[model samples]
Target: MNSDPNNQNNFEHSEYFDKENIHHKMEPVTAAFIALIGIFIFYQVGGAILTILIFGFNFENADINAMRLLTMGGQILLMLLPTLIFARFVYPHHITQILRAKLPQAKEVGIFIVGLILLLPLLQSFMILQNNLLEQISSTFPLLKQLMNLLDQMDKLLEKTYSSLLKSHSFFEGSFVVFLTAVVPAICE
Candidate 1:
């Protein structure tokens, strides 16, 4: 029956702010809406600025390296920056807790490697099946066949562009490429 606002025990026993099972202050639905809006805005704004800086009104073709950098940088900005902002300033959640992330033990890593090795044949079979299905569908529909050919051309062009960006002549360059393409994206997510 203590009527003291400053009593530490009061907060400990409160129903709304339970010390035992406190959760994120922001509602899950609100957080999801904010996340979607943040991503949309960040992608549109960041891509525009990058394009202006790199291309400068020349939309015909962009340098492969510049395009690669832009794509990676955009993802970091759109995904990682907003999440960090919300976690630190808005809701102030622990990074590990919010992300549900932890460094896996060596045994976990070994198990993952074994799983991938065991699944390789099945994964390959699925890829082949997918391609065969696409081919069959395209053959049945002339319009779809034309559309598929166009998509294939576009895919090849993109593949070539990405390959050009990924080509690294030296060890340091290769490491940088991996960092930009793999490490940075993983961290952003």
Candidate 2:
């Protein structure tokens, strides 16, 4: 058995430093707890700060329309910044190791594409069925009807500008708006 420092006991050191199998490297429960705390703090405190900054601590029914745009931009940045910072600083090593896994095979990618193509129509059909069921239930259930009324009240609280922004659309136009709202945010994020 060669006892030279460089040649001896390669397996022993390899076991200690191996990075390929990241699933084995479990995150501590404490870390998860801290991450949750961080998220809560980020959201609550960040939202409060933004509200105060934009609206100047108004308790009454203050007109907030001018602040609404700034609020949206600030809220988005606040939400994403904490998560990004935590992931980068607190667990960079673990994240990088996990992301080093092999890329999806061509067949897997093709199957995923086919699955999505099939899924869209099925999802839309499911949603239509769900809406019909809700309508039927609301006819019988006063509570469900009241809930729908409450939702309508909430919608009315939004500005006419926002309501108009939402309502000025055909099906294709609505789909395009939804796609831009969802996909652009995801891509930018």
Q: Write the per-residue lDDT of candidate 1 for residues 45-101, one digit (tens) a residue.
A: 877787688777644377766776777878887778877777664446444444545
Provide the overall lDDT of each model, using Cα atoms, as 2-decimal numbers: 0.75, 0.60
lDDT string for model 2 (1-189, tens) is: 334656534433454435454343236476567767877787678766876776665423545334444444554666556655656665555555432334456898999999999999999999899888988999999999999888867556545535443442478757754554565455324
Ten contiguous residues with the weakest lDDT in model 2: 17-26
Task: List the candidate 2 regions with Cα displacement exceeding 4 Å.
Answer: 1-76, 88-112, 153-184
Top lDDT model: 1
lDDT of 2 at 18: 55
Clashes of each: 0, 0
lDDT of 2 at 93: 59
The alpha-carbon RMSD values of the candidates against the true structure, listed in the order shown, are: 8.2, 9.8
Q: In TM-score terms, which candidate is top? A: 1
